[model samples]
Target: MSQTTIQISQELQQELNRMKLFSRETYEEVIWNIIEDTKELSNEAKRDIAKARKEIAEGKAVTLSDLREKYKIQ
Candidate 1:
């Protein structure tokens, strides 16, 4: 939405310049990858929450002690 300049270490900048890593294709692919990963995690979180709510509504939920006993954990 807005343009801003980010400062980086001179050594890192020099490395990027030397490698010519500022290509449009590289930037586009990186952004696309980040968005895709975020979407997948969001969907997974929603599914897990829905499952928990369903379990609670169906009276299948347990208390902390129940969980500890079920798992045999201290």
Candidate 2:
């Protein structure tokens, strides 16, 4: 595996050191959890946008005026 070096502040280094000693497993798990959550959100956003476009193409979507009225806007 290739190794990379990064620069960090003293405060961040101390916090990482404490996490390494106190919760090594959780630290790694948290990183993966964040990555997975980001991936899921990205996928959901793409799906929603695609569905909206399809609705527009099929003439199933409402106009901007309808949207404003639906939201109770003037």
Model 2 backbone overlap count = 0
Off by over 4 Å in 1: 1-41, 67-74
2-74 in candidate 1: lDDT tens per residue? 7566677899666555544356444335546657767745788889999999999999988899999999999
> What shift in Å separates residue 71 of candidate 2 from its native position after superposition?
12
Question: All candidates' TM-scores?
Answer: 0.33, 0.33
**Looking at candidate 2, what is the lDDT of residue 44?**
80
Residue pairs with clashing backbones, model 1: none
Q: Which 10 consecutive positions of candidate 2 have the poorest summed lDDT?
A: 19-28
Candidate 2 matches the true fold with a TM-score of 0.33
Candidate 2 per-residue C-alpha lDDT over 11-49 given as tens digits, one digit per residue, 9 for 90 to 100: 976765565534555545554665776774578888999
Question: Global lDDT of each model?
Answer: 0.71, 0.73
